[model samples]
Target: MTTDAIASSFAQYVTESPTAFHAAAVARDQLVAAGFTELSELDAWPTEAGAYVVVRDGAVIAWRLPESATATTPFRILGAHTDSPGFRIKPNPGVRTGGWEQLNVEVYGGALLSTWFDRDLRIAGRVVDADGAVRLVSTDAVARIPNLAIHLDRGVNDGKEIDRQRHTLPVVGIDAAFGGTDVLDWLRGRVGEAVSWDLFLADTQAPARIGIDGAFLASGRMDNLTSVHAGLRGIIEAPADGDHVPVFAAFDHEEIGSSTPSGAGGPFLEDVLGRVQEGLGATRSEAARAFRASWLLSSDAGHLVHPNQPEKHDPTNRPRPGAGPLLKISANQRYMTEAKGEAVWAAACDAAGVTWQPFVNVNTIPGGSTIGPIAATRLGIPTIDIGVGLLSMHSVRELVHVDDLAALHGAVAAFLAG
Candidate 1:
C-alpha cells in the first residue's frame, strides 16, 4: 500500500472500530477488496498462496501457505487482539437521578480513569439484527460520555476511587424524559437505520502526530487496535510466494482472559490451523508437526517510560517511544519470548536494520497480560511478542509516537516479507 493509502486506512480503522467485531469486519473488507480469498470457519480454506480467512466476529486469521507442504511444515503467524477496554451497554442500563438520567455501563477491561475525564466520548460497535446479520455502527458525530464537574468531586484529586458499576457509568443525558428507549431510538436513527445489536461506548478520537517534531501519536484504543491495523495490512501486503503462508489473527476478550471462541485461549487458532492442514490433505499428526514448526508473533502494546514517573521504570530497560518496536519481557511470563524466540526476533530486526529495545517493569509493579503465552501453548510453536511502547495504556487517550506508527508498519511488513 502507498503512504497515502496507509494513512487513509489507519484513519478509517481508528474511527470505525470501537469494538472487536467492527474491527474484524473493517479489516476483512480491506483484504477482500485487495483480491485476497476469504475463508470461513464453516468451510475449509484451500491451502494455497494468497488465501485469507476471518474467524468469528472479533477475530480474523488469514494465511497464504505452500500447496505441497504437509502439516509438519512450520507456519508463520501474527496475532493481535481487536478488542479494547471500554463501557458495554448492559441489558437494563438506564438510571434517573438529580434530573439527569444516564446509560449505565460495565467496564470491559482495565482503563485509566483519569485520562477519560473531560474528553469527548462516543458509542460504537457491532449490532446483530433479527435476521442474524451483523452491521457495524458508530456515534463519531456526537458525545455520549461526559465527565462530572471538578467541584462536585473534590476528592477526585485526593485519589477518588471510581466504581466501575456506579460513578463511572457514563451520563448519557441530562433529562429523564430522554432516557432509555429514547436513547436507543436516537442511536438507531443516528445511523440512519434501525438495529438491535451489541453496542459499546467509546471515545471517537483520531490518532495523529503530535509535538513540534512530530514525535507522538495521541489516540484512543491504540493498545490492540493499532496492532490489529498493522497485522491486517501486513497480511494484505505480504507477497504471495508459494508455500509461505501469511496468517493473521485478531482475537477478542484479551483484556480479560481468552476462554471464549473468539479469544486466544479457545478454538480460533487451533481450529484454523487444523483446517489448513486437512484442506491440504495432510494427516492430523502432520498438522501437529506443521504447527510445532510454526512461529506466532503475538502483537500487543508495551508500556513506555512515563515522564512523570521516571523512578518507576528500570534504569536501563526503559523503552522509549519512537525508537522502534519494544521487546517485552516479564519474569512471570506476561510475555512469551524464550531465548530462541528473542534471538529470532533480534535477527529479524538486524536484517531489517530497525532499532529495538527491551521493555520490563520496575520490580514492584507487575505488568499486565497479553495473548503471547496462550498462542505459544496452543500452537506449541515458539512465540515472540512485540509492540509499540505506549503511555497511558488503557486510557481513553493513549500516547505513542507518530513515527512509531510508520515504524511499526515497516517492521511488520519486513517481518511478513521475510
Candidate 2:
C-alpha cells in the first residue's frame, strides 16, 4: 500500500479498536487474511516453516518462519501494547443523584481527567453471561461528563483537582424515577445475554487528519496503537523468507504495569517463544542460546518537547513531531535501550533511509515506562525502545505527525527484514 493508504488504514484501525479485545480480534482477522494459521496453545505446534498466530485473551503473537530456520536461528521480535488510558465501568456502577442517572467509573490508567469532561462517550468491552458465553459489546454515544460551570467554581481558572469518584462520574440520563432501565439493563440488551461485564468508556469521536496541511493526525488511543499498527504493518510488508524468525507481539495491560496473564510482564511471550523454538526443532539448551541471540524492539509512544513547555524535556535531547521516531532512553532503565540496542535501531534507520531522533526526560522529571523494560527483564533479551513523538499523551485524544508514522513503519520493516 502507498504511504497515504497506510495512514488512512491506520486511522480506521484506531476507530474500530475501542477495547483491547476488539483490537486483538481485528489483528487476528488481518493475519488470517494474510494466510497465517491460528494455532492453539493447548495443541501441539507445527514444526514446518510458515506463518502462524497465537492469541490469548487480549494479546496476540504472530510470526513467519523460513524453511531453513532451525533451533539456533535468532528471532526479530517487535512488541507493543493494545490497551490505552480511559475510564472503566465498575461492577455496580449505577447512581442517581439530583434526578440524574450517572455511572460510577474509575480511571483505568493515568488518564487526563479534565479532557474527558464535556465529551460524548460510548461503552465497549467484553461481557460475560450467566451461561459463561463471552460477547463483545459496543454502543452508541450514551453518556456525557459535562464540566461544572465557571460561575460555580470560579477557581477553575486556577488549578482544579478532580476527585475520581465525584468529578469523573458520567451522566447517562436525567430521570427522577430511574427504576426500570438502568445502565446494566441497557448493557444487557446490547450484550443479549450478559449477566456482568467489564466495560470501558471510550470517546465517540472518530480519527481525522488535522492541521492546516493535514500533516497532523488526531485520534484516541494513539499513545500505543500507533506502535501496534506500525508493528503489524512491518510484519506484513516483510519478506516471508529471512535468516531470522520475524515475530510481532501486541500485548495487553501495559498501561497498568503489565502484570496480567496477557501482559508483557507475564509468561505469555516466553511461553510462545519457547513453543516456537520447540516447533522449529530446538532442544532446551539450543532454545536458550537462540533467546540469548534474539533481540526485541519494544515500540511505544514517546513525548515530544511541548511547544509551550520546552523546559519539560531534556535540553540536549528534544524530540519533535514529523522529524522521525525517537530512540527512548532513561538513566533509571525505564526504557530498555542500551548501547547495543541503540546500534540496532540506528542501523535499521540507516538502511530504511529514515531520520531518527533521541528522547530523554528532564533531569527533575521522570517519564512513564512501557513494555520494553518489563519484557526485557522478563526474557533477559537485548531490547531497544522506539516510538513516534506524541503530544498531549494520556489525554482523551492524542496527536502525531503523519510523516513520523510512516518513518516508524519503514524503520520497523527494515529491522524485521534485516
Candidate 3:
C-alpha cells in the first residue's frame, strides 16, 4: 500500500482511459490478470467463489466472491460509472471548411466546454466491425480540440453560448485536412484499418503529479474514471474474508440520463444480480430477499470547493482536496443517501484512516446528479453516494489531491472487504 505505487497506478489509469469502452477494457484486463474470472452477461455463471467480470454494451461490473454464501449474507456492492461528458461523434459527422478537417461532435454530458478549447485532442473507443468483432482504437498525438481565435469571437469574452452543434468542433487535420471523400477512410486508418466504429475525441495527455508538494493530479476524465479505477482496485483488492461478497459495477450512458440498455436505468445490473444469486444456488425469492437486505455505495467524483469561487459552496459542508472522500448530499435527493446510510459508510472511512467531507450544493441554483438513487430505487437496496473531491469536473483536464487517489481506493477497497 505505497502512495507512489497508487500514484503510478492512477497515472496509468488516466493514460489508458479516454473512453468508457477503453476504460472498461483496461479494468477488464486488470481484473482478469489479477485472477478474476470473466463472466458473460449472455451466459451462465460458474457456481463457486471466485472473481468475475461482466460487460453489457460499454458498461462493466466486476467482483470477488465470498468464500461461501448464504441467503442472509447480503452482497456488498460498489457502483461507479465509466462515462464522462465529452464530444461524441455523430453519424456522418465529417465536415470540411477553410482547408481544415473536422468531425461534427455533440457534447454528451454537462461538460465544462470552455476548458476543452486549445487542448490536445485524440480519439479512442471501441470499433465494432461488420464481422461483429469489437476492437479498441485510439490516436494519441496532436489530440487536441482547437478553439476559435479570440479575435474571431470577441463576444466570447462577454456572455455568449457557443452552439455545440454549429461551432466548437475540433480541427483534426492540418490545412486541407478534409480535401476529399477519403476522409472516412483516413479516419478508419488512424484508428483501426477497415474498422467501422464509434470514436470520440480525447486528450492524449497522461496523468501526472503537479504543484510544489506534488499534491495535485492533472488528468482528463477524472470525474467517473477515478471512481472506475478505484472501484476496479477495490474489486481486485477485496480480502479473503468469508463474510461478504464484494461487487463493482461501471455502466455507460450515465452522462446522458442513463436511459440506455447498458445504463443504470436498464436491466444490465438486474440481469447480472439475478445470475449472481442463481449461480450461488439461491432461489428467486431468496435472491429478491438478498437484494432487499444488501447495501450499495454509488461512487462518483464530488466537487471540491473551488478556490476562485468558494462562495458557491455551503460554508460548513464544503469538501477540500486532500481532505478525503466527499459525502454527497442533496435536499432534492439527487444523491441516494440519508443520515443512516451516510453513517454506515462514514464508519468505513474512519476505519480506513480516510478523512471525509460533506457536499450539499448551494441552494436554488440546482446541482448535477449521480447513478445512486437511480439504482437503489430500481433494486430496492439501501444506497449511499460518495467520492473524491475534484476541481474542474467535466473539464478536459481536471485536478485533485495526489494522496486522495489512494485514500479513495483505500476507502472503497476497505468497504468492500467489510
Candidate 4:
C-alpha cells in the first residue's frame, strides 16, 4: 500500500480501538476478514498449513504456517502491545463534588497527565454481565478534565504541577438533582447491568493527519498501536511459502511492566507456540529446538530527537521522524537488541529496501523499557527491539511521521518473511 493509504488505515484503526480489548477485537475482526480462521484456546488447533488467529482477553496472536513447515520449524515473530498509558476507571466511580458530577480514576501507567486535561474523554473497555459473558463497550464523548483557569492560578504558566488524586477527576456532568449521576447506572443503561468491569478512560478525538503537507499523523495510543497496526498489516500481507512460521503477537499491559496473563512477560506466546508444536506432533525436545532457532522482533514506539529538547537524546545516535524506523538500543538491557539482532534487523531492512536509524537515550537520562527484554527473558528467544519514531510519546495524543510508519510496515513484513 502507498504511504497515504497506510496512514489512512492506521487512523481508522486507532479511531476504532479505544482500549486494549477493543484493539484486540478489532485485530481479530480484521484477521478473520483477511481469510484467517479464528481459533479458540479450548479447542484443538489444526496443524495443516494455513492462517489462524487466537485472542486471549486483551491479547491476540496470529500465525501463518507454511506447507513445508515442520514441528521444529523456527518462527519469525513480530511482537507489540495493545495497551497505552492512561487512566482506568475506579470502582464506585461516581462522585458528586460541589455541583459537578465526576468520575474517579486511577492512573494506569506513565502517562503525561497534563496532556489529558480539557480533552473529550470516553469510557471504554470490557464489561462482564451477570451471565458471565464479556462485552466490549465504549461511550461517546462524555467527560473532560478541565484545567484550572489562568485567572484562578496566575502561576500556572510558570510550571503547573498536577495533583493526580486531587486534580485528575474527570467531570462527567452536573449534579442538578443534588445526588450523584450514578455512572454505573448510566453504563448499565448502555451495556446492561454489569457485575464487574475493567474500564478505562479514552480520548474520544479521531486520529488525523496534521502538519503542513500532511507529513505527520496525530492520534491516541500511537506509542504502541503504530507497531500493532504495522505488525497486523505485515502478517496479513506475508507470504505463507516462507520456510519459517510467521507470527504476530500483540499483548496487553506493557505500559505497566507486562506481568499480567495477557502481557508479554507471561506464557501466552509460549503457550500458543507449544500448542502449535503439539499440533504438529513435535516432541518436547523438538519444541525446545524450535524455540532456540526462533527470532522475535519486539516492536514498540521509540522517541525521536525532540527539536526543542535535543539534549535529551544521544548526540551521535539521534533518530528523527520521517527518516525511517528506529533500532532501539540501551546499555542496561532495557532494550533486547544486540549485535546479532542488529545484523538481523539490518538484513531485513535491506531486503525491504527500507532505511532505519538507531535510537539511544542520552547518558544522563534514563530510558524506559519495552517488552523486548521481558519477552526475551521469558521465552529465551533471540529478540531485537525496533519501532517507528514518534514525538510527544506517552501524551494523550502522539505524533509520528507518515513515512516512518509506512517504512515500519515494510520492515516488519520483511522480517516476518524471513
Off by over 4 Å in 2: 176-180
What would the per-residue lDDT of candidate 1 be over residues 84-167, giving only the tens digit for each residue? 887788765666667666676777888776666556777777776666676777775344555667798877677777666666
Which 10 successive residues of model 3 have the least lDDT summed? 174-183
Candidate 4 Cα deviation (angstroms), residue 19: 0.2
Model 1 whole-model lDDT (C-alpha atoms): 0.75
Query: Order of all candidates by lDDT, from best down to worst?
Result: 4, 2, 3, 1
Model 2 over residues 1-418: C-alpha lDDT tens digits?
A: 6667878989999988899988888898888898899998999888888898988888888999998898899889999999999999997788888878889898998998899999999999998889887777788899999899999999998999889888899999865374545766666677787777878999999988899999899999998999989888888777788889999999999999999999999999999888888787799889878888999999999998899999888888889878999999988999989899999999999998899999988989888999998998899878999999999999999999899999999999999998
Per-residue lDDT value at 153 in model 4: 96
lDDT of each: 0.75, 0.89, 0.81, 0.93
Candidate number with greatest lDDT: 4
Q: Per-residue lDDT tens digits of candidate 4, residues 65-93?
A: 88998989999999999999999999888
Quote the lDDT for 395 in model 4: 99
Which residue pairs in candidate 4 have backbone atoms (N, alpha carbon, C) closer than 3 angstroms, thus clashing?
none
**For model 1, which pairs clash?**
64-245, 64-246, 66-243, 71-290, 72-290, 127-197
Residue-pair clashes per prediction, in order, are 6, 0, 6, 0
> What are the models' TM-scores?
0.92, 0.97, 0.95, 0.98
How much is 149 displaced in model 2, in angstroms? Answer: 0.6
Which residue segments of model 1 deviate by more than 4 Å? 1-8, 47-49, 141-144, 174-181, 185-196
Q: Which lDDT value does model 2 have at 309?
A: 90
What lDDT does model 2 reach?
0.89
203 Cα displacement, candidate 1 (Å): 1.0
